[model samples]
Target: MRRYLRLYKLFVLQYLKTLMQSKLDLAIGIAGFVISQASGLVFILLVFTQIPEINGYGIDQMVFIYGFSLLPKGLDHLLTDCIWWIPGTFVTHGGLDKFLIRPLNVFFQIACEKFQADALGELAVGAALVSLSIARGAAELSVLDVMLFIVAVLAGTVIYTSVKLIAATFSFWYKNSFHIINTIYHLNDFAKYPISIYPKFIRIALTAIVPFAAASFYPASYFLDRSSLAGSIGIAAAAAAVSGSAAYGFFLLGLKSYDSSGN
Candidate 1:
């Protein structure tokens, strides 16, 4: 474990060096994400202007959910963004060869390859909006609430990563599953709103299948006192564990079939 941590530190340092060498690119990436988040916020504002509430959820509550979603999304994006590369061009281009030749675990090596600075934008905007929700008297959190919030966020992050892994692992067979991964990941956008507003099928799918609702709406509902703490935190943790285990199993199966471009 110590050795693994040391190697991860090295990976982080290398990425930092690369970022320092491309400061302008880093700035653009961060700014681009920040602007994208700002645009989403603007859309939410426009939405509330047209409708007084979305399925009994007030603007403040909806915004709280939106902001809460970003916390887990940004945390996952920062750490495991490299998985995006796998389904994009890495598998087809034989990039896994380099990792396979090393003694380290392939998934660990791939995940640690990059540190996404752009995610800082998401984190910044998310924190600001959640704080804004509190300022608007949307919710009051006590010490225990804060602790549970942290646990919820961590579990949510795991769910995001596990979902990405499940999508990206398909690249082992399809060679380039970028479209699949992109389509699946974008579904999280729906989680930014109240799931109750959606149709029964979509609500069930999000809650039980993709389970992005566990990451955002459910946890946010707890904070807003719109749902039970047991249901919120318990459901989130359960989903994370189940999905994470399933994703890892799928990844192992995929790795077993990995042939590289040579095969």
Candidate 2:
């Protein structure tokens, strides 16, 4: 276990250095952070203007959701670098061969290659938003609430990573099928708001079928004192387990189809 962790650390350092060498990568990363903050600002302003509150979701809750969403969203982009190339190089040229030769897990190697340094800005913005919301909103949050909130967020990360892995794994059979990935990206829009506000069907789909809610909605709601302990943790935990298993299955199945470059 320690050896694996050490190798993973080295992988991360090498990838980070590669990203640092590229000016374009730095620009894109910063751009992503700026765009996220700008979008959050616009949403907050728009929601604040139209109705003093959105279905009883206070500005603070909304901000908390915004901050919550950006963390995994940013980390996914930063850490899982090969996510964007699922339908392209990985599929067409069998780019995954390189990883197979490495000692580390292929998925982890791909993730390391796709580091998101620019998300530093998003992390900063999110932390600031959370602080501001706490200052402006209610105090005296219980310790349990904080713990549950952390659990929900961590679970959300697992769900997001698994979903992307599932999407990427599809490339094994279908070349250039990242359209599915794009669709998943669109679905992420719903996560910015409270899932409870959606129709029962949408809520169900987010929880059961797609599980995007496990990423931000449940966690943010838990933090804001909206979701029940049983429901929120249950959904998040189920998503982590099920999606992780699914990703693993897809990966093993896909490995059967891989033809090394020399062959």
- Highest lDDT against the true fold, candidate: 1
Clashes of 1: 0
Tens-digit lDDT track of model 1 for 93-175: 87888888899888898889888988999998999999999889889988998899899999999999999999999999997
Candidate 1 local distance difference test against the native: 0.89
The Cα RMSD in angstroms, rounded to one decimal, for candidate 2 relative to the true structure is 2.3
Estimate every model's Cα lDDT from 0 to 1.
0.89, 0.74
Q: On residues 160-225, what C-alpha lDDT tens digit does candidate 2 reach at each position?
A: 777877777787787777888778766877887877689999988888878888778776766677
Model 2, clash count?
Answer: 3
Candidate that scores best on TM-score: 1
Query: What TM-score would every model get versus the actual structure?
Result: 0.95, 0.89
Models, CA RMSD each:
1.5, 2.3
As a TM-score, model 1 comes out at 0.95
